[model samples]
Target: MQADIYKENGFFLDEWQLLEDEQALPTEPGRFLVSLERFVAAPEAFASLPEIAILVRAGDDVTVLAPHLDRFTMVAIEFAAFSDGRGYSSARLLRQRLCYHGELRAVGDVLLDQIPLMRRCGFDAFKVVHEPTRRALETGHLAEVPLYLQPAARPDEQPAGARAWARSPAGLAR
Candidate 1:
């Protein structure tokens, strides 16, 4: 089944070819996404695979994947359920702490209501399966509030002026 792909620009594009669960890893180098377990089990095999991406589950530690970040062209965080929000923190850490500059995507259980927050958390792409969510994304039906209370991982985004503490030095008085 083909999913609707949303990029940071809020445009729908089908450039990526998702690897199905039943499909085996391609022998030739090409763009592909693999499960975290499969990639961890045999990191060397994927090391040489060009344009490789990995699917990280909510519980998986981002630190373990840090060393191999340079090898991946993208890192997709899996959201098993809409209630599972651990993926948000993972994306933030990958962007703010690990400094992963590649594509950060949200896969599985992606909904229209969550796209705005997901982008703030540093997800640049989304693989949404629901038709309503896809339409909402395509038509700009998302009721996004541009104001942010806290500073986001993206350096270009400044914190809201209301939160003076965000801009002040840790030990300095506002």
Candidate 2:
């Protein structure tokens, strides 16, 4: 069974059902998250499906998918590997540039250490397969520092310090 982790009231909780690889697309009406490739290849097929979501890989071009953002209830960005940081950029683009308001999820290679950064980048849900990471999330001991030096896509984030540039018209520090 695949377990999905999501944050609720400042704590992580498991509450999601990931569609299996071999399962056929549900035409009978239901919620399902399809791979980015599948969705891109045949968008018309899934366009009318109820509660559709898409899983974005590291190399996928988010810009191309911008037009379809409103069609999905959620967007899952795959980390693939901890060293690969493209997912972070993708999340930022989706939230900041595209203005996606639905749930943004982080999946694969989701370590506890990366959760804080992922959240800052606009990931509200995380699919943590690692046991240690799961434990850390459950215990609420992810060792995350609330302070961030840079401004992120989320409006809720506060600058690390008060600076003239930080409060400038652009709202970004030099």
Tens digits of lDDT, candidate 1, 1-174: 454678857656555556765677788756888877777777886656678888889899887787889988889999999999999999998998999999998999999889888988999998888899978877878768668775777778767644776557872653
Q: Give the root-mean-square deviation of each candidate in angstroms.
A: 3.2, 3.9
Backbone collision count in every prediction? 0, 0
Q: Which stretches of candidate 1 lie over 4 Å from their true place?
A: 1-3, 9-24, 161-174
Instruction: Give stretches of model 2 more than 4 Å off.
Output: 1-3, 10-24, 161-174
Q: Residues 56-130, candidate 2: write the lDDT tens digits.
A: 888998888887888988898998899999999999999999999999989899988898888889899887789
- Predicted model with the maximum TM-score: 1
